[model samples]
Target: MLTQLNHIRARRADLRRDIDVVHSFEAWEESCVPSYCHPNWLAAYVSWIRLFRAAELARTIVPAPARILDFGSSVGELGHLVSEGGAGYDFVESDQHSADYLVSRLPGARRVTLEDAPEGGYDQLFAIDSLEHNENYAELLEVLAGKLAPGGVLILSGPTENRLYRLGRRIAGFDGHYHETTIYAIEAVAERLLARRAVRQVLPVAPLFRISAWARKS
Candidate 1:
């Protein structure tokens, strides 16, 4: 895990050098990429570790070499872990710039549209820190769950939105206007469509994020 984290840090540095950090479109601000590559050690550590935790949680259920889809994958940071495990990686990124960057980083990974994501095509589906941004995350979760093959797992992680989480976001300089709901709300809806397998609290001491795994109900 340490080795993987180092590799991610290096790649994040490369991304910072390659991409525009202060763009007018707010894309940079919208992306967690900046946070991952933040010069401030604490900010960067928090952002990168969250993805690490999410991917680590995923590996517990969806072992390597499985067909995987990273929904709303931002520039495909998780693709590093997916590729390392020899999994067939696919991603859906609505932001064209991020999508192009993701392709550049993980050329082997397929880029699929949300509507075109093959149903029952993936053995594992991930929606880390992405679903809560959408008001229709419940409907989106249902559709994403459908893309999973029988016995497949859907791994998720998002802000807890508790006071602690809100405080952290403010400290990090984000108002979190993009988030339509909280991870708690998302999980509540997920329980209706999938059976919960496991749950972990990120930064268990402070408990800012929730990482969960679920499978389609039998």
Candidate 2:
């Protein structure tokens, strides 16, 4: 686990350099900066890679030209990537700043909240790194599952049971703010979904830090 964490940190360093080159410092600061910069910017950079991976994996399941809902979308970065593949997306974010940013960045995407999310179903739903933030994640999962079209897929990913990772974050002074609201165990939630037959498969997204479960609603 330590080795894996080190690998992630190294990769994050590389990505940070790439981001610097691709985006002006001011632009990157505005859109990509994290609240805490202590112990480096690992948390922020790692999130960017994770969201990108989640979006890529989601595309494999839903493909292009499908309707998608990005629940708890922070700045809608993943939704923007998925939309590039010709998918229409509705973004649900509780943060008004993030929602406004999404609207500006993704003009075609609809911005809404969970309560106001469009009725009916979507071809694909993404909750990357957002589930852990919800104290009532299980209930939200059930609600999200109900929003999927027949054979539609829900791509969910978040950190799970990584004591070492948590410790590192704590040492880095990020514990106070990072994942403070995460309460659900990924395994338990996955089991509940499986028992209900709401999810046909629960696949881990390589590296034990995060799990991406592909739940298909029948």
lDDT for each residue of candidate 2 in 1-218, tens digit (9 for 90 to 100) = 47545644554454444344243433333233342122355555455566556655666665663688988776666764677632478878776665776676578888766777655568778777677765677888777776777656677766553665577556644443435244237446655663222222122332324535455423
For model 1, how does the per-residue alpha-carbon lDDT over 174-211 read when each residue is reduced to its tens digit?
78899999998999989998899999886778788889
The per-prediction tally of clashing pairs is 0, 0
Candidate 1 stretches with Cα past 4 Å from truth are 23-25, 84-87
CA lDDT, every model vs. true structure: 0.82, 0.58
- Quickly count the clashes in candidate 1: 0
Q: How displaced is residue 212 in candidate 1, in Å?
A: 0.2
Model 1 per-residue lDDT at 127: 94
